[model samples]
Target: MTAIGFVTRTTHGGFSGELNLLPICAHIDIVPNRDKSGDTSPDFRIFTQGVEVGSGRILSGESRGTDYVSLSLAAPGLGVRKLCANLGRTVGLNGDGSFFLIWNSVD
Candidate 1:
């Protein structure tokens, strides 16, 4: 089981409720080896709030041997506040591994 939580937020007294993120969490399993058939690359998609925000090739030599994918989201322009983010990843072709996180606001 994979769990994530903010020890504390810098801005407010009660920050947990605003994010919809639990103190602990778990994601689906990912396949160990996706190269069984020696295909070029695996297909992967990432969604936030049930909306497809990002998609790309998984381990297709972009970073080399990176079993994990990452993303960073921030307000479009500087000096703008009130923001939240959710990141998700699917490791391999078998659809056995997945992970996600909901980030608290910076405001």
Candidate 2:
């Protein structure tokens, strides 16, 4: 299994916030944008324990060289941070920072 690490921040009491280490399994599908002509546009479908939990697309960063993916969780009742942690554990991607993707590998 491969790991993909992401940084998560949770706000508390309307003033304080905590930064947490989050990771996700690499059993993901990078679906190319069919509407477009090339494979440059991709959408990520993230899975945990062989079940899909979230999907996201890469977004252009407000600043140069700062692109990020915006995830939309569909695992009912799970916050973004919790979902990240759970997905990481389920697919054995619990690491730090960002993870490398090994294509054509099975989890």
Candidate 3:
């Protein structure tokens, strides 16, 4: 896997940064904010392969006592299949201020 861009958490323990998708020419922008109940807002924007795909605020969910956030993004008409196929294995941020979207083969 290769790192495409980097991200940093804000003072409020939320993500507020920019990440470049590299070679693909896409970018991700994250904005951190809280609601009246102190819930972190998932305000994010996604650009797929250099074109603006989708944008929205995701709601947080819990599973097995663990809280997590999930997001789904895709370009108009083209759908997520293409984006997912292109992104590959996993797309995640590292605690070390780096992010990567890799395509891994399970051999």
Judging by TM-score against the true structure, name the best candidate: 2
* After superposition, candidate 1 runs with Cα above 4 Å error: 1-42, 60-107
lDDT by residue (24-49, candidate 3, tens digit) is 44445433323323334335444444
What's model 1's overall lDDT?
0.31
Model 2 spans with C-alpha error above 4 angstroms: 1-42, 77-107
The candidate 1 region of ten consecutive residues with least summed lDDT is: 9-18
TM-score of the candidate numbered 2? 0.36
Clashing residue pairs in candidate 3 (N, C-alpha, C atoms within 3 angstroms):
none
lDDT of 2 by residue, 1-107 (tens): 33334322213201011212243233333232345444444355545555655554666656676655554444543443333312221233433322333121222
As a whole number from 0 to 100, the lDDT of residue 35 in candidate 1 is 40
Model 1, span 51-80: residue lDDT tens: 333332333325565443322332233134
Please provide the root mean square deviation of candidate 3 (C-alpha atoms, Å).
Answer: 7.6
Output the lDDT of residue 45, model 3. Answer: 44
For each candidate in turn, the TM-score is 0.23, 0.36, 0.35
Instruction: Arrange candidates, best TM-score first.
Output: 2, 3, 1
- In candidate 3 the C-alpha lDDT for residue 100 amounts to 36
Q: Give me the displacement of residue 94 in model 1, in angstroms.
A: 23
For each candidate in the order shown, give its overall lDDT on alpha carbons. Answer: 0.31, 0.36, 0.39
